[model samples]
Target: MDIISIIAPMILVFFGYTIGSTRIITGGNEALVERLGKYNRKLEPGLNFIVPLVEKIAIEKTTREQILDIAPQPAITKDNISVEVDAVIYWRVFDWVKAYYEVEDVEDAIGNLVITTLRSAIGRQELDETYSSRSEINKTLLEELDKATDDWGVKVLRVEVQEIKLPDSIMESLEKERAAESEKQAAIFKAEGEKQASISRAEGTVQAIEMIAQALKGQSNSKEVLKYLVAQRFVDANQKLGESNNTKIIFMNPKDVSEGVGELLEEDTHISDERIGNGSN
Candidate 1:
């Protein structure tokens, strides 16, 4: 009975030692083993062995990539505009030893660093620039974070500026300014169209006058024809004026227009006769 008790106790001790020393680190995870409270070695995924009671698993962390979402924080722009800014960072641990020992809290340190860098970057740019140059800000953040976190064994894969929110007053002002600008452009375009329409109408009138003069050049009764045309134009003008809602209709004498057309036609005939005489000579 004494021999059996001793052997059974030895077997129990062996089984306890075996169970205590064996560590099954799952895939995508790594562990740091410390010997006598000092970092001794890294335990990779799968079955790992360690000295029981002499060594300990100090920390176990996953090697997979992680996401850090920075909440919206108040920031002042270069132009002294207060705004809210937020971002997201994608990172991973490349060297576990440095990640564990070099920084007290790698995640916290990275987050704080990102906040400081983001503020600095925003402070260097105006509010308008911040909205337009989001890519530039993101690049600056990624570069700064990657450089700063190198010693911490953290690789910042990318940085994204999620949102930049402006105050309601500022947004309303910008909207008003944009609306005013659009109205000004619309007014300019309307004025340009009216001006072009006036030019086209004047050109059409001149062309009609030229065509009438050409048609009447060789006619023997050109003066009579001109008188009829002048009378017709006067009648058409009175008809158009009468069609208007606000126009005052003043009837003109046909005799007066006929007399004016006679005078103009006489002057034109005299000029043409003089030209013909000079050509014959």
Candidate 2:
């Protein structure tokens, strides 16, 4: 009976000790430990021992990555274009101590920070720049969030901008502007081509005129060349008149013909007189 009485107290203490010792799961986490309402060492994963009725856990936090979605918020671009943008953030707890006490709600704090940062970023850029520079903006947002949440023991992994909504009218106007610019460029190209063709034609005509002038100068004293030129002119005139379906009678001036014949005779007489004088000498 005395052995039973003594063993009872020991059994109760053993039971209490067994209850105090715990094994946290591998994928789980815990936080600051307090013994007798005083701060003690932090509890980690695996087996942990504590004094029954004296040690208690004050705050428990999970050290796993968390996903947070930011609600859509209105943003105004530098060009006065209003848009709605939403995003998501990936974060995890880096410091368990600060994560437990430094911030009231880490998720909520991060969400608000992201909203403000995105607003500021969008406001500084135009609409096109905002859309094209999303990657840069996301990098800046992650940096800013990491710095802001450092005290809270939060590590921001990445920020993703999900959607950016612009007004229908703005989209339509942008499309029209793009099309107009393309048309203007096409017109400029066409005008340039025409200008080049005209220049080439003018150059060719100038060269032809120079060659003709050279030939005329070389044969200035040839009556046969003059007759050939006159005959070609007459043929071209007749062809043009025939194409016009007009039967027009053309007459030559007798006086002009007589004058040309008289000049030829005078040239021959001069040549013969020169030959006779040489012979007499």
Candidate 1 shows a clash count of 0
Residue-pair clashes per prediction, in order, are 0, 0
Assess the local accuracy of residue 57 in candidate 2 as a C-alpha lDDT between 0 and 100.
78
Q: Model 1: per-residue lDDT, tens digit, 171-242?
A: 999999999999999989976876686578658755765567667876888768877776776677677657
Q: Candidate 2: where are CA atoms >4 Å away?
A: 23-25, 36-38, 172-281
TM-score of each: 0.76, 0.59
Weakest 10 consecutive residues of candidate 1 by summed lDDT: 205-214
Model 2 Cα lDDT, one tens digit per residue, 1-281: 69999999999988878977663534467667888887787888777776668787787777888899988899999999899999999999878778767778777778888899989988988988988999988998888889989999889999998988987897898899999999999989976876686578658745653454345443445445544444454465446546543245465654464356435545665686788899999
What residue runs in model 1 are displaced by over 4 Å at the alpha carbon? 131-133, 210-265, 276-281
lDDT, residue 219, candidate 2? 46
Cα miss at 62, model 1 (Å)? Answer: 1.5
